[model samples]
Target: MTSPGSIRRIRRIDLRRSALTGGPVDYRRAVPRAEFDVEAAVDIVKPITDAVRERGVEAILEFNARFDGVEQTEIRVPVEVLHRALEKLAPEIRAALEESIARLRATCQAELETDAVTELGPGARVTHRKVPVGRVGLYVPGGLAPLVSSVVMNVVPAQVAGVESIALASPPQKEFGGLPHPSILAACALLGVEEVYAVGGAQAIAMFAYGVEASATTEGCERVDLVTGPGNIYVVTAKRVLKGQVGIDSEAGPTEIAILADDTADAAYVAADLISQAEHDPLAAAVLVTSSERLADEVEAELDKQVSVTKHAERIGISLSGSQSGIVLVDDVEQGIDVVNAYAAEHLEIHTQNPDVAASRIRNAGAIFVGPHAPVSLGDYCAGSNHVLPTGGCACHSSGLSVRAFTKSVHVVDYSREGLAAVRDHVVTLAEAEDLPGHGAAVSVRFSEPSPVESGETTP
Candidate 1:
């Protein structure tokens, strides 16, 4: 850990000074973001995906040996192993995971949408139905942390959405005899998922996209309809490369948090929240945008004091001092809202006198925690909300993983002869205008007289 007094201070950006100059500020450009390039990694990831496509399990074993530093002949984990892991799980930890699962399941149940039928007129009806994906591959990071909670986050929604088949993958640990972390396996067991693999990194994603052929020693792994979860840059790049072959939730980048606080916010609470996210990785972003300069100064001091004693001080220090993480000074709470909206952080926390009012104005965010009492860490585990959210300003266009992500919307149209006749003229006119007479002919032929064959006459 870094020395208490030597911890680096978080940098500051003074947007208030820019506002005073009476010049327009491009908030998006002014905001700090991590330098993430998924496209540049295509050359490195494409070969691995191709190899998995051709060689199947052979290529997966090679990549696992090279990246995960574990040697195993078979990738699929046995059902007995999953049971053993759950059997050995500590009582307290098991209780905590069970509670988290129940809470998330409840939320997912409430989010389920029912089919809706609409009648345009007599004999014309349309129905919108929600269909769940058949199968899904959920990846859990086992690098810095096991992230056992991720199993619950990904599985509960997929299960709640009525997905039938679920497969999970995590890196193999040499210390655990070439198996994934025991906690991860236990969580899978608890969720009633029988298909688990001890694979990791970009190769695991390829295994899901192309699938592995059955070998003499290993059973075949079938391809999944969709893949969801969070992982490192390499895993994210693989998802980007093999997107069309298999569906992906999003190209998730590094974790990030943006706190919109004011003079009423407690400095200690603000400082601790920033450090919590920074502990995830050196690339994680922890930003503070506040109107009160006094609050900003206090947050900085609190960060310096708290980071020095934390177990991951060295890692947190690097993230806090990096270009992606900083403190931005705004003119007032209103300006602070604009800065945060433009930032579109993965997690946005509102800390003001009226957090509800501030939260209502927010137009873009993966998830909003309204008040100092509700922290990002709560959502990560047992807050009944998903932690698999979009990063790198993706919240502006996308959303966090939920029951809806695992389902597809299909429109069912029903029409009678009368319904067809009602719109026949309009269809003919529009089709002719667009030079697509075939579309109109299909409708017109339905109403026209039957052909000789349809009338039971044989052609000569």
Candidate 2:
């Protein structure tokens, strides 16, 4: 085994030998904690948010200069510039983006829902209508990678949900002359998003939550009703603090992938999939919970060979060797499944001989990939499954970004005179039982030509 500090070292947990209390070891306790503390980050971003609230766009520009190091004269990118970015995009990349957009659009359209009308009686009905949010702000991180696919991921669902007004904001790139990366802009153009902004981090989220007051340099954005998309700690913290002000997708943590494999699984395929996720960030977790010691050793060796030649080798190395990433040796395939379920990874891959059976048993995961061919990278780009999934065990309770995330369900109740009469006594009875005489009175008063007890009194 290599030393912990070595890039080649990945923590190995032999659960069979450990003194874990329960039948299944709590995998989460063994995993490395993220450097980002959202609560602590709240303290750091509170002042920035307060400043933005006080000064508006002037504060955004100040934060942009202080944090992003790019001084943008104008926040919103011109529509013409968005179009030009598409025209100049490389043909191969553009073709790929177009295919991704088409695939995602088709999937989103299929997921589109219709209003349901439930008729309780002849004259009364409750219609559950799916309403698209009026306006939204989408964030795209312009960090390590360009993440052009994110533009498609965030924009397509909102479009499918019929969101009329959409605004996208990414960190201003110094290389792009104080604008978001051309690829990011090109994606906006491809999706027909006219409103784009050159901003990023906490400031951008702040800008979206409380729209900047219109000024000489910019027309300013309308405060969005909802905000979706992923970013770093500061971005997540911004979303957390501004939750009530605007709707947010989820408080996403570091990216994670958990592979539940057996002796029959391919070692090379497992290693490649693990490496793909590790490239995202140093905190990105690539966990393998497996029954076969032989397969684990093979994967460890394969990772060494593959990571050495990858483009982002340094980043990938740090991620794999970090406490967050490792291999957990379980007693058997069933135990592996138990371990993964407890971990509730963002992405779970089943590479067993009975992949379908294994995948079907999974209770917690943002998305499940079956067999060897369905890699996490495929889902990230063209799987048609939204890539903005919950991370850091959030898959246990939360869902990924989707058309449903962009829509709000509203119940429309309609009651005729007879229908009101039918439920009036029941309403009055329940309201009175709850000790609210006024509520019962409100219902009884409507049909108060004269109650049986009040027949002697003059009707008002």
Candidate 3:
């Protein structure tokens, strides 16, 4: 396998000199195609999902042994273990988690919307009421890095939306005796999430979509109404295939960052942010769309200096050199903005003379970090913003995971006798126009007056 340290060169694009139009600057040269083919992945994971659906927990345990290299006697984590993990958590880490929960809670509360009632006319009204999903499954990745913070991001919003039943799943750790990372368990405990599983990847999602049978002390896993959180392509693929069976947040692909900067931006700060996101994975994208060539050159040198000493230096190097990661030189900040919007990065940072002004014009991005003081890393952990966002250009249409993702919007219509009479003719006309006589008959019968019963005495 090629190591990250050997990767030394990152590509650069000069849009100002090229014949590229802002209309559709082909990103084939700049953006790397995702490694996972959802179509092919569908075939690969179909059997696994089928097995889970057929055999339930038995198939889950078998897959766990075959893939994760861990044999679980019991998949469901016990309540006492969760509490113990929290008690043993580091004091500083515990404090930080508490703060994150507080911020997310406060923000989520503000996002909670009330039912909206619209008065079409007297005695005729329509209501848009928001209701929480009954149950949810949160998947936290245990590969590459143990994402303990994801626990807070996924659970808090669901809790705020008042989801009654919440279950969490993470890949079991061999070093930790077939349980998820201790920190993951601890975060779950802190969030008061009692149900957790030692399953990961497609199998974990499968287990959530199709409830597993009761095996050992683990009560049978109940199928969730919705699943939310970021995961690998397989996890994403499972969500895609099982979308109707259960709702999903988004098909989150590889993480990415795009920084729009100018001459006034700090090269060191820009370089550090790019390196920070690159540390995520070899496929992670770190893009720099800047108006200043001097700034780009300086940032490149800064990336070289910064990537060398990082703990995940090899991974960072590979990511920076990948086609997906590069610097794009635009004619000016206006052109740079156009490129960033087209790229639609998952995390977009503005480091220009007037970052707020520049940020205001951005049409698409999962999250915008304004000014040099704000970084994507802060949003990932504690920016009071949900980091579970749309990825792989999905930000153009979809939104980041939030309270809205967990709730369903339903419209309630009410009409009185007078209201029905007023619109009865319109409804009948439309229904007849569509050649659906049954629809018109149903409405016409409601308006039809009952025949007067024959009385013994004649009307006076």
Per-structure clash totals for the candidates: 0, 0, 0
- Candidate 3 lDDT, tens digit per residue, 200-286? 999999999988889765667999999998898889999998888888999998899999999999999999998889888988988
Candidate 1 Cα outliers beyond 4 Å, as residue runs: 1-7, 17-22, 450-460
Model 1 is weakest, by summed lDDT over 10 consecutive residues, at 1-10
TM-score for each of the candidates: 0.96, 0.95, 0.95
lDDT string for model 2 (1-460, tens) is: 2322355678888876454666744666765445568998999898888888889888888888888788877899999999999999999999999999999999999999999999988689999999999999999999888889999999999999999999999999888888999999999998999999998999889999988887788768889999999899999999999998889999888899999999999999999999999999988999998888999999998988888888888888899888888888888878777778778888999999899998999998999999999999999999988999998788889999999999999999998666888999899899989999899898787686856544565547
| Candidate 3 TM-score, true structure as reference | 0.95
- Model 3 C-alpha lDDT versus the unseen true structure: 0.88
Better of 1 and 2 by TM-score: 1
RMSD of candidate 2 to true structure, Å: 3.4
Deviation in angstroms for 3 in model 3?
9.6
lDDT of each: 0.92, 0.89, 0.88
Off by over 4 Å in 2: 1-8, 17-24, 31-35, 450-460
Considering every candidate listed, which one attains the maximal lDDT?
Answer: 1
